[model samples]
Target: MLTEEGKKRRDALDAEITERIAAFKVEQRKMLEELAEIGIHVEMVNRLPNLPTSDYVQALPILIKHLRREYSEGTLASLARSLAAKDASEYWDELVAMYLASAHRISTGPGNLAMALAAAVAAACPKNRLDDLTNLVKNQRLPHRVLLLTPFKKRRGRDPAVARLIEELRHDPALAKEIGRWKILPSQASLRSH
Candidate 1:
């Protein structure tokens, strides 16, 4: 435990991770600004694939920290949607963390956050991670429960992982009863509004 070489190696890795996180934040801000200029929308979400990947596996937790503390509701939702569209498997855990950390924000309401969480879960999470999605669906927020269920309600062939999630929920009597109470929650204001 007291080896100089090991300590040096650890220090170097930490420094590299810090540098990568900084770079990712810069690129994320630049992309957000670009989206800001164009107006955040489905079209903006569609443009995310054009941006270079940030190698999120290297810096996901840092990115999630930045997202949780600083990003606006619309921007968070847009980024989540973009991540969904990209469907980068490496991004799922941090996406879930971001959703859990910020889901209580009253600014966006649970609807948008739930939608974003659903999109991220549906697009990025693999079959093995279905348990995480199930846990997220059990979030205390009613909108989280309802909105997370939305993606699963789609055709089974569209996303089999999500379909599996639907089946899992169906077998859980508690979730089955909860899913039945789904209601129409109000949508958020336009994404263009800061």
Candidate 2:
């Protein structure tokens, strides 16, 4: 099943894949070193492989500080998920700022930073920031804007403002389909397990 040219081509392809893998490993190591140099510590970087379940308190501040840095999308997604695993309410402003800044890039590719940031904001958003959250829902840049409504789902039964917001979103022609889809889907927390 192997002509000489086919064998050669296969070998060349294999070599290219191996080289790309090696380059990727080198880049990962350099990124880890840079994170360490910026006071992220080795343990925190190590915990990235586990994410959201591992203890992330020590690395939270450093991650937030570098939120706007030019790291890979996967790295940003991991950081956002880790923030969601705890009560990040104290860092609400910072998290929201990051979400707003990255809104344009969210939902565009495989490592969806928007979904992760939305989950973190849902976990961290305070009662007082409901208005701000509502505004985020209206941002057209975030194609997955419905994810921002998770907080309202949690509070709607107990808060009239949240209930009214949901009703308003349901009535909006632009948002009705997403709102309906969200209603049928499993909660975001459950989805995160996968």
Top TM-score prediction, candidate number: 2
Q: Candidate 2 overall Cα lDDT vs. reference? A: 0.66
Superposition TM-score, candidate 2 onto the true structure = 0.63
Model 1, position 44: C-alpha lDDT score = 30
RMSD of each: 17.2, 7.6
lDDT of 2 at 46: 27
Candidate 2, residue 186: how far the Cα is off, in Å = 20
Assess each prediction's global lDDT (C-alpha) against the native: 0.53, 0.66
Per-residue accuracy of model 1 over 118-148 as CA lDDT, tens digit each: 5665667665765676677765563445545
Report the lDDT of model 2 for residue 88. 69
Off by over 4 Å in 1: 1-29, 32-69, 108-111, 140-142, 150-194
